[model samples]
Target: MKPAPFLLTALFSAAVSAAPATHMDTKAATEAVSVYYRNPNPDRALKIMQTIIADPLWKKDSARHNLSVWAAQILRQHPQATDKWCRAMKQYPAVTQDETAYFFFLANTSESRKCLRNLNISNHSKTYIAQNTPPDISSLSNISPADLDALWTTFYATGNPKAVEKVLDRVLDYAKAQKAQEKSNHKNIDMTGVAAAWSARSNIMQNQDIRKIFDTYLNRLNATDKALLQKILVQE
Candidate 1:
């Protein structure tokens, strides 16, 4: 078909624009990754980091803070992405140290702590690590469902549904055990927390075997609660 000159120019311009972006090479990718890293979307951050990290010829140290943060986010909804995130971190020295304390506490594995040991840590960060312990999750009170999403972020990073379910069991068991306490802290049962927590994992769980585990939690609610939760899950 005969094409308009503008259309041909547009396509050529598109190719040129893409050339710098794709055939663009490592130097440019590294710069782009560093600048917009502060942008909020972790998934995009991870992809950009991958682009920069993919270039073995590139030299400067990649920023640890953004890599850790975005890696954690990508692993949340996309549980299978653990290897990509983990491998990316492994390439950058002490980027592991850049991971937030919340993730350290959330996963609290020997491996997570091992990252701190290799790093030249500050006295303050050292003290924080030495004193670190699993959060007193059972005692959480006046905690809204939205707040619970923070906890979910930690578990999601693990990319293990069993881990998520275990946390649920602990919280539910404690809630069931402390009938008096539950009543006293009505705010603690904030259904919104469950919704928020689900929101993090919702995308990954959809149409997967692991999704059933998430659904099990949802099933605990009444029809109205379930409907409300579904809406929240699908919302932008």
Candidate 2:
């Protein structure tokens, strides 16, 4: 006997709902998991993720992808949970390229880097690393202004200085272009953001002398701006 049209529609909806909710791609899932990490209810998010990982009917590839990404994020927030998820990913070879890269970033182990370097990443995954990894400013040149803004917001929220510095340099370059385009007085330009960015940069710099870099940038501003920076530096 044929199924009713309404029953078929309901079945399709159920199937889609039961499927894992990932972003556009595996990399997008990485980003989403990062956002979830910063949320106040991280424990709740963890429980939900654990349920997803344990779902027997879930595709092995999708589970591996989700668990690997979630594992790296969990390591950053809760280090103890790392081993179980990492082991699961290793046991299941279906983990995606982005997940492997994330593992390297979180694991910070030689073995993890070796694994990342050997993974067969697609051009898209390479682009993701170029865009997201810290200490790489060149990638910012290829991104759009809106995306750069979003990147700035995320970096600021995460307080991940390495990632912040990469985008901060790009923001400075973008600010320069904005200045030229608007023909605004240098003093009139909103250097509040500039100060915040520089302060964040200073906080992240491990080298004591690198504070000079922020100082040099601060010197270009007016006395009030200099004072504001001084306040930030003092607080730090």
Candidate 3:
């Protein structure tokens, strides 16, 4: 008479629910719920989520705001799932900014940038988040380099090159500032590292071929530097 996995998951979820909704507990709960959703049994995940939601504690706990976000993400990931969770996200405007950004990234298909734009995010913060995301390379494998470059350009521009150019200029300026700071703080800064950064900036400014620029930059690096850069770029 072993308990079912879903029952175990539900019990664990209930234990989490009983804890005081501290910021740390909220984060843990979000992650636990996400793991449960990614489980093969969608029904089980749905049941666990429903149990958590039905609990009177969550009904009044403002700290569990992020739980709704995780629920939306879980629902979106399921093939047969409805848009109910997405609608719920919209209803809860107090949802975390990161959660909102993640929702657009997950749910929107036309363009991740377009999704962000529709969120009415400020221009300054948009680039920061978008660049950090660096489109999933695997998903883009079928996408031609030219198409990717165009997509990236369009994303940065918000469909307007003139407006995006300013954003690019600011990005370059920030890079330069960072380079200067690194040189000043670390006297042994590698020259090749500096050159690669400049080359990347040049590529962006010229709207030149990004892949080619990356290749050229990589070729110019020393063996040690190349290895280091590869380690930084390539990840699971």
Clashes of each: 2, 0, 0
Tens digits of per-residue lDDT for model 3 on 106-153? 333444334455454445456666565433322432333222232233
In angstroms, what RMSD does candidate 1 have relative to the true structure?
A: 14.7
TM-score, prediction 1: 0.36
Which of the two, 2 or 3, has more TM-score?
2
| Candidate number with the higher lDDT (2 or 3) | 2
lDDT of 2 at 159: 34
Candidate 3, residue 41: the lDDT equals 51
Per-residue accuracy of model 1 over 1-236 as CA lDDT, tens digit each: 00111111122233335444445754454344323323435455556656644543222222332233324444444444444444545565543334333233333445544544554445666666567554433355544442244334333333445445544543444334344454575545545444434443443353253466658876887775555544544443
How much is 115 displaced in model 2, in angstroms?
8.0
Scored by Cα lDDT, where does model 3 land? 0.39
Where is model 1 more than 4 Å wrong at Cα? 1-107, 110-115, 131-149, 158-220, 227-236
* Model 2 stretches astray by more than 4 angstroms: 1-81, 91-102, 105-107, 110-158, 161-169, 181-236
Looking at model 3, which ten-residue stretch has the lowest summed lDDT? 1-10
After superposition on all C-alphas, the RMSD of every candidate to the true structure, in Å, is 14.7, 14.1, 16.1
